[model samples]
Target: MTLSSENCSEFQYQVLQRSQTLDANCLLFLIILGKMLLNILTLKMRRKNIYQNFMECFCISLAFIDLLLLVNISVIFYSRDFVLLGMRFTKYHICLLTQIISCTYGFLHYPVFFITCIDYYLNFSKTIKLPCKWQKSFYFSTVILIWIFVLAYVLGDPAIYQSLKTQGTSPSQCSVYVSVQGYWFSFSMVIILFMAFVASWPDIYTLVQAIRITSYKNETILYFPFPSHSIYNINSKKALLPRFVICFLGTWSPFVLLQVIILLFKVQIPAYIELNIPWLFFVNSFLIATVYWCNCQKLTLQSIVLPRDPFVNWKCCFIPFTINNFEQIEKPISIIVC
Candidate 1:
């Protein structure tokens, strides 16, 4: 078993290369799982009439595209064949393909955000909407054009080109491009979540004391006890904040933990996979919440309408406390059990 030094070095190299490839596969698998979960949640939470809004259209399209891309990647890995369209997709080529997607996705982040914001404004303000006949075509064209523009932009960008340039080239190594954007975004999100959790910590008990589920004729309703002198207001983020913290943390705590782990380990994830639907939704929720918080006065005056959230339903939280004369009050109420 006494081997030559050259042979031992070669064996070690093979082992290291295998490890790297395995790591890459595992990372890709995790991304696929996350996308699957997001797709399911989106569909479950989506309204039955999806065409009611452009945001839903965009959401469905993006989820489908992400799923399609991941499926394509999976097929290649499973078949162990890198050929497609009579062309070969070697390690570097596959990595390049994914990086292109990541870059394009990253670039479109702000555009999509602003577009959603505009969508909300128009819907809430009851202003400028396309005729029903033209709505679908209009939104479709917009989403398509946005994708085309971002893809073209990413391809032309010199920074992306520079990032794709390699340090070392070897058949055993799969080199993928990454950006500081992923790290910075993840780190910032972790900080924001931590702060939000801390700020909501003190108000948790007071929020709990003001609500209860009551059964009447076998139908249960989540009744929030809002007395004339009490603190919970229907319009304020103060009352909404704790419920958001509960639902948000309940649904996305695992993803937040993943971000924390990635940050701690300094994982260099490609921006393409890193900037996903969940992250975008997280940003969307935060932006909407910030707007509401800043306009608490307007909210109290009934000027601002709360936008519909695809993931977290703001409609679930309500108040109904100090009901001495229940017969005198005639208010619209929901019957939700537990």
Candidate 2:
């Protein structure tokens, strides 16, 4: 009996060690991925066109915020047992901090996609035009106001603040907990879900428009000998819009739905889902980063290849004009008459 007990203890120790190692590896991967995304977005922002575009600026800003969130998570995960600033941070503190940051920035993700849809609508539609002078200022102001509103909302809510301060910390797990009975919590989830759906409607409309436009262009090009290179470039950029919309919906919609179900119905989410929902943000970030990289590649290729001038083939040949005096022509007629 003693020998069997010793073997079982050895097996348990080995399993525990492996689990710790796996957790460390996953954390390291997330950090590296976040760094890569930050670098790519920084490079994209450096480009003149990207800097000038409102949507691209928003995208880069979102990426930056996401990276900060990821870093905070990494710090919280790795330092769960460590004391900071002469104070011990329990699991509740870590979860509270994470929740606050995520809530503040997380609301922006869906809006970014909605803004992208608007950008596409403006680009493809002929009825509306935004002036160049006001575009940058307008978008910049809007982004700033959004951040301010989110901060105010979180800071001004007494119930949310109190709950964060008083939530119980589990000894075995550091995770975010939402009180199902909290009115603010339930209300926030409803708001988020509503916004998500509202944002998706425009995306769906824009996608259908994109598909119809692409097919029409393809058909037109098939019959025309001189296809406009500019049209091709515009279409390529439009392609990215749908891809991004799809990716954003895929990565975030399910998670949002799960939250809605939990908050509204007071259903207990499985341990596996509760543990994995946070990772969806990381996945969303990765997809956006991939899109940025693909865009950079397209830009590089465009820079290398000069676009052909549309009027080059239509140049007319110059013909010399000869003018003859009336008297000079009459002399030849008179000589023939004589």
Please, what is the TM-score per model?
0.69, 0.38
- lDDT of each prediction vs. the true structure? 0.62, 0.43
Model 2 has an lDDT value of 0.43
Cα error, residue 41 of model 1, in Å, equals: 5.3
Candidate 2 — which residues are off by over 4 angstroms?
1-53, 73-93, 109-134, 167-338
Off by over 4 Å in 1: 1-34, 45-55, 74-88, 165-203, 214-222, 230-267, 294-306, 318-338
Q: Candidate 1: global Cα-lDDT?
A: 0.62
- Candidate 2 per-residue lDDT over residues 125-219, each given as its tens digit: 32456676687777777777766886678667898566545543432343444323232433554574365446556644544343211112122
Tell me each candidate's RMSD, in Å, in order.
5.6, 18.1
lDDT of 1 by residue, 176-280 (tens): 556565566667768977887788876755555644545433434344445567565655667666666655665577777888898898887766566666676
